[model samples]
Target: MDLLEDYRRATFFFESGDPLGAARLLEPIVEAEPHNTAVRLLLARAYFNSAQLNGAEAQLRVLVEHDPSDHYAHHVLGRTLERAGRFREALPHLRLASAMKTQTDYQEALRRVETWLGKNSAA
Candidate 1:
């Protein structure tokens, strides 16, 4: 299989909103090139977009471990956890991502998670 072609197709699938198809195309690429951060990131995003939170979390965890300085990975991991109702576990990751990057989206996610945690804890 042409990995590059597959990657491009996966990217197209993802951009076209067929994340499950993108993920299916990415899985083999990821296994063949485990060290390719870009492929893994795309795969994780596909999983996240497809509502496969567990897969997204797993991929994001590996990314964070591979490169702790990857703020995007941290942010996504936090989001996956938040979506899965693990706010407490997600907080640190969200905070770390926000601290690492000054993106508005990051801060917004952090705020959202914090608010969720607050409201839930008060219950």
Candidate 2:
């Protein structure tokens, strides 16, 4: 199938709650287009939703390194790290995302991580 068809099918799989299927469809596309941020982001999200935290973190880290000003990348990376029990590593990215975008979701995530850090640190 063409790239567009693959992308459509991947999106359909993702929307239908089959993240593993989506990731399967997206993996080759990502390999073929390493610089395609949109495809990479979608693959990262698929990995994340499928509980592939390491894959998601790897893709997100690459995205952040390629474009540190990408607020969404930072936000997603932070969330992925937090989900992986790496709250300390997630904080700076979350804080940067919040500062860059001022999104409520980002702020909420930052707050949640901060609280977790505080609780853990006090222990």
Candidate 2: 10-residue stretch with minimal lDDT: 114-123
lDDT (Cα atoms) of all candidates against the true structure: 0.96, 0.95
Stretches > 4 Å off in candidate 2: none
Off by over 4 Å in 1: none
Locate the minimum summed-lDDT window of 10 residues in model 1.
114-123
Q: What lDDT is reached at residue 45 by model 2? A: 99
> Tens-digit lDDT track for model 1 on 4-107?
99999999999999999999999999999999999999999999999999999999999999999999999999999999988899999999999999999899
Clashing residue pairs for model 1? none
- Give per-model CA RMSD: 1.0, 1.0
The TM-score of predicted model 2 comes to 0.96
Error of 2 at 66 (Å): 0.9
